[model samples]
Target chain A: MKLYNYFRSSASYRVRIALALKGLDYDYLPVHLVKGEQSAAAYASVSTSHLVPTLLDGDAAISQSMAIIEYLDETHPQPALLPADALGRARVRAIAQDIACEIHPLNNLRVLRYLTHDLKLSEDDKNRWYRHWVESGLEAVERQLAAQPGRFCHGDAPTLADCCLVPQIFNAQRFDCRTSHVPNVMRVFEACMALDAFSQTQPSACPDAA
Target chain B: MKLYNYFRSSASYRVRIALALKGLDYDYLPVHLVKGEQSAAAYASVSTSHLVPTLLDGDAAISQSMAIIEYLDETHPQPALLPADALGRARVRAIAQDIACEIHPLNNLRVLRYLTHDLKLSEDDKNRWYRHWVESGLEAVERQLAAQPGRFCHGDAPTLADCCLVPQIFNAQRFDCRTSHVPNVMRVFEACMALDAFSQTQPSACPDAA
Candidate 1:
């Protein structure tokens, strides 16, 4: 398997964490988003969406980090990323989507560029936009965690939610988003970071990290 | 099952189509997003993220439309939303996320509000932001669909991708995004809209739709 991804992309970070958790080996093919390498014609064949963290398994190429993660879990069943039961899977997926859909999309590099360049927002305003989504989105995750009350996002084991939470928290801290209010979320982040899968595959640990 | 959702919400409409496709009955408990009902204390208890398209099944309150749809699919196996094979499922999910994560999140109400209200962009600038994501995002979907030509987004059956695609197309048309660029996507949209599951559960057909 060859994973085409960027170092700092939260979505790429997610697939990295999932791969590490499953103890899978893959060649890391870095696509630099800042340099606009993702827009090149060569990268477009790998990913129609021109997004990072596309997993190429033999002849098959899977885009979308969540879908890639799910594909990994489905193919490699042991140490499941989702829960065994349907309801449990729903809870974990809900939490994952809470971050993947609600927060990270708004604060991604392209959106920030659009804010600063197209909309003519100042650097301060751009940072403010970044912080706004992260802070409020984490608060919601905090509420969900408080309700569940586990060592990880779902249970004793780190599931898909943890895979998503850890990366978003990393991005949050990178932008200096307010984390004080969401103690439960922060606690989970700490627990996740303690794991080798998360710590070793984080953005900075990637080959292309600036 | 009771679905606490808003009419015209792409996420909500996605779940509605999923339920309708499965031939399952769900109570449509409308949460008017435009009326600020999603931010209420009552809603916060139901959805930690305070987002629409939260499905309440017995005691379990599942948030996130993708999660809800997956949960529904899990419990009701016939007329499955995902493909039988792992690789096939990955393809369907990638198409779904191409819209859900990439396009729909940007054009959603709160983000648009943040653009016009917080960033103070003119109406035209806000619409430009909306069209930019939709047009570009749909073009990506078009490329994916062209690669995997079928009667629907996946095969002859309307999988999760079609559920996501139809609502997004509705929103694109509502906002007058450039639909002509993506003929394959529009072709699938036409194919999906022909189905009762897609047409009957659409935004305009909903009880709360204005």
Candidate 2:
């Protein structure tokens, strides 16, 4: 497997964690988003969206971190990313999407560039924009986990929800967002980091980390 | 099944189309997002994220439109929302997430309202924000579909990609985003809208359209 990855990208970080959790070995081919390498012709040919963490498994090159994680889980089902039952799977997916859909999209590099360059917002305002979405979004995730507080986002074991949460929290902390409100989320983040899978695949540990 | 839905919510609209496609009977319980009904205590009790399109089936309440749609498809499994092959499923999911995670989240009502009220941007600026994401995002989807020009997003049948795309295009048109570049997406949207499942469950046809 070959993963087109960026060290700091939340989406790329997600797939990295998933691969580590599954104990799968993959080639880490970095596409530096900050350096605009993702927009280059070679990377563009591989990923139509020109996004990082595009996993190439044999004939298939998959984009979207959640989809790639699901693909890995389906193909190699040792430590499943999703739960066994349909309802459990739905809950895990919901939590994952809660962060992936709501928080990460708005604060991505492209969006921030648009805010500063296109919308003409100040750097401080852009940082504020970043924090605003992350704080509110994670608070919602905190509520989602309030009823089912466990070692991970779903149960005792880590699932897709945890994969997404850890990366978003990593990004949240990078932006100096207020995460005190999301105690449950923080607890889960701490638990996830204790495991070698998450700790080893973090942004700082990545080959592309500056 | 009961869907805690809002008429114009793009997320809610995706589930409605999925339910209709499966010939499933679900009560449309409206949660007026514009009226701040989703944030109310009662709705929050049911939906932790306080988002519209929370699907309640028996004792389980599923949030996240993509998750709900997947749950419905998994439990029903007649007209499959995902493909049979792992690679194909990955492709379909990538396309769905292309819209769900990237395009829809940025243009969500909360984000737009934040742009106007909190960020103090003018309405025209807000619309530009909306159009910028939509146009660029749809063009990416167009490139995705260009390689595989079937009747639908994946193949001849309507998968989850079509379910997500149609609603997104509906919202894009509502905001007057440029659509001429994304002919494949528009073509798929037109093909999808012609179907009874997509046509009958649209925003205009919903009970809470006002």
Cα TM-score per model: 0.99, 0.99
Per-residue lDDT over B149-168 for candidate 1, one digit per residue giving the tens place of the 0 to 100 score: 99999999999899899999
Where does candidate 1 clash, by residue pair?
none
**Candidate 1: stretches off by over 4 Å:** none
Q: Across residues A8-83, which tens digit of lDDT does each residue of candidate 1 receive?
A: 9989999999999999999999999999999999998788888898999999999999999999999998889999
Candidate 2 lDDT tens digits, A1-210: 999999999899899999999999999999988889999999999999988879999877899999999999999998988999999999999999999999999999999999999889899888899999999999889988988888899999999999999999989888899989999999999999999999999999999889
Clashing pairs in 2: none
First chain TM-score in every candidate?
0.99, 0.98
Error of 2 at B15 (Å): 0.2
Candidate 2's displacement at residue B38, Å, is 0.6
Residue A17 error, candidate 1, Å: 0.7
Pick the DockQ winner: 2
- True contacts recovered per prediction: 0.81, 0.88
lDDT by residue (B1-210, candidate 2, tens digit) is 999999899899999999999999988899988899999999988999989889999998999999998999899999999999999999999999999999999999999998998888999899999999999999889999998799999999999999999999989999988999899999999999999999999999999997
